[model samples]
Target: MTQPIAQPAQSTVPASKVLDRVLVLEMVRVTEAAAIGAAKLIGRGDEKAADAAAVEAMRAALNELYMDGTVVIGEGERDEAPMLFIGEKVGLAPGKGPKIDIALDPLEGTTITAKAGPNALAVLAVAEEGGLLNAPDVYMDKIAVGPGYPDGIIDLDRTVTENVTALAQAKGVAPSDIVACVLDRTRHDDIITELRGLGCGIVLISDGDVAGVIATTNEDTGIDIYVGQGGAPEGVLAAAALRCVGGQFKGRLVFRNDDERARAKKWGITDLNKQYDLTELAKGDCIFAATGVTDGSLLAGVKRKKSGVMTTESVVMRASSGTVRWVRGEHRAKV
Candidate 1:
């Protein structure tokens, strides 16, 4: 059984100090809850069921954070999702602590979780109001690399070959030596073809850009760069993670339809294709929490036991001190 961690009382400290404590505990709590929800849907083969469980669990956990946290980018629109919708207020009402903005992916890979595949996770990021971008639910073209590369090494306007060559040159390696991670979707055919032409190795994922972006920061994963179009919400979460690890990421919004374009208008985004730097997605110091729903490079799947279940999470960086923490929790099943 997985058990909830005991939370300390809300502090009357400064906003910075309060954020530090909230980031650590809130992330751990929500991640564990999301893992439990994922575990409950295991073997069900219902993606919506798995996502619903994770969303509900994560929503409840956020309510306990004791801050005036708002869901800047979340599950869906105000009328679309019952919980964690855009502009929804979370955390304690008033007189608590700092007012923050939150962006989350309760179940980053709904299909992956239902299929019990790789790279599925429950991810969330928090920053001060106006710190996190309230991106609409739309596709985003992304290019990312780990720390040490010069700024502007990759941009959305650049061709895949040009970006790959630049990254390879920056790393002092042949183009063939670079490995890029991309979504295994037909839309990425041109990018994939270009990468192949450049002799760069490619790693394909079915879902979960959070894992793809984080993979770039870890040498063992062999994912030198991540280039593809994925959810804008996941892009912000990835930016939060990369911020902690000293990585560089850039994204550009891509709206596929009028509905999506209209949604962008709600956020004051006129140029739907404008590039967004990592800092533009998530600014200042922030905390990012993620727990694997099915298994991934950064964390493991939820472990179910007779009485309860255990879930593991990796926090890329602390908003307060820039420290990373890996947390595991257990919860008992209700009788």
Candidate 2:
């Protein structure tokens, strides 16, 4: 006889001067709620609708936190998104709580969720005031690897084969055993061909660059490195995740048009070609949280039961302590 599970409660607020540790699970709630909200829309074949559902839910959850949080990276600019816009302030008592910067993706893989594909996620990154990079929403070229290799083992300036070869040597493994995860797009065809020539294994994802970047950090992922072009906002978010888990990540802004470059300049980016290392992207102590919307590596998808309960899987990380906690929650439907 199985009884209905109790409703999930709030996060554990560990004592700390800064809220990184205390707010770890609070951050998870933001993503978990968004994932749960978006999960209901899965396979509905409406990308925008699903994204909107997630954004609304995430924004509502963040507003309940006890922090003076600003949306540094979010749905879009102030004029673009209704909620969670860049520069928008969240939290119940804005000036009365811990000050922090937030970067988030309400529905990371919108198309994937619409198609019921894998790896869709709801993610958020938090840092003390001025800790996170105020990245504009634009394309960025990125390369990353999990911790344990010497610095400079993989350089973005190098060719794909050269980077893979160097990484294999650093791991002391054969090239064929080194698996790289890259976004599956037409732009990556050349990269794919190059890796194939070098006898490297490649895992291609349709979307969710945040998960794609963090996959390298977990040995279970079997991803030694990740390389490709993705959103700049996501790069900063990924860097924050790596900061908590021990990894090396580098990204450079990629502008497609003069307007894009102009926007970068607006955000105080003086050098278009300057590469940003992990610390440069997310400095000091920070926390990152992500919840899986659909099943994929790194985390599991949200599930619903006949008892009107939903289950969510999430990972929360704090850079100051290098603590990574995986949270599995069962949420009861509101009465």
lDDT agreement with native, every candidate: 0.80, 0.86
Residue-level lDDT tens digits of model 1 in 20-69: 56467767778778877876786679998898999899888888877888
TM-score per prediction, in order, is 0.91, 0.93
Candidate 2 lDDT over residue span 1-54, tens digit each: 111111112223232465645588889999999999899999999999999999
Best by TM-score: 2
The C-alpha RMSD in Å for every predicted model, in order, reads: 5.3, 5.4
TM-score of 2: 0.93
- Give the total clashing residue pairs for model 1: 8
Worst 10-residue lDDT window, candidate 1: 4-13
Instruction: State, as a TM-score between 0 and 1, how close model 1 is to the true structure.
Output: 0.91
